[model samples]
Target: DAAYLQQQLQITLEEETGIQSTQGEFKFMVAADAYEETERVKVNYTSEDTLQQASTSGTQSDNAPVYDSDGSTKVV
Candidate 1:
């Protein structure tokens, strides 16, 4: 039942992170001797890095701007 519980926890995680249930990838496993009422679970989430990288790349693209011959500045 630990594996099942882990899966349930993963679902709950998607709600908390706002990553969308289908957008992120997850791997969960019970990190205990067995499936017990007081057992602990281990989860490996692999999306935060991707999200961070995307945001970093997006910021770099913001530097692009239109140039004017009159030396005027404008953001578009």
Candidate 2:
């Protein structure tokens, strides 16, 4: 659905009032590029499942996690 939504938003709507005529006169939608720039969510997960568990003991000097500039993480 992300690809479909992205495709639909790419079409210029400045002269396409007919597309939204039945909706409402005052309705507005944010531009596609604006949506791409905004943050959606940041969740810190916690669980007992093997693949899903997070470190409950938290950060320690020798075993601290390293976060990269590109948003990846790794155990040090």
Candidate 3:
């Protein structure tokens, strides 16, 4: 569950900030719920300015997918 949460958090952070962060140490604090039983997943990300610059000027455009279709998107 930690791994899945980490991946989801990474994707969400990247989409929001355009920065990717490696998973650092994680700490979990659990408290008993009175009504329901569920734990919230919270994510924190930190990236250096160099990483931001690299991501901005990196191969993002080159990594875009191109499709050859007649005004329609069809997957075969």
- For all predicted structures, in order, the TM-scores are 0.31, 0.20, 0.23
Ranked by lDDT from best down, the candidates are 1, 3, 2
Model 2, residue pairs in steric clash: none
Per-residue C-alpha lDDT of model 3 across residues 1-76, encoded as one tens digit per residue: 9999999999898776643222221112223342124322211123455677688767675566566666664443
For candidate 1, write residues 1-76 as lDDT tens digits.
9999999999888777775533443222332335542433322123666778888999888877766888777797
Candidates ranked by TM-score: 1, 3, 2
Provide the clash count, candidate 2. 0
What's the C-alpha lDDT at position 6 in model 2? 73
Q: What is the C-alpha RMSD of each candidate to the true structure, in Å?
A: 20.8, 20.9, 27.5
Task: Provide the lDDT at 34 for model 3.
Answer: 21
Q: In lDDT terms, which candidate is top?
A: 1
Model 3, which residues run further than 4 Å from truth? 19-76
Q: At residue 74, what lDDT does model 1 achieve?
A: 73
Model 2, residue 22: C-alpha shift (Å): 99
Model 2, span 1-76: residue lDDT tens: 9988777776556336656763454343445445544533212222234333334344345477689998799756
Worst 10 residues of 1 by lDDT: 37-46
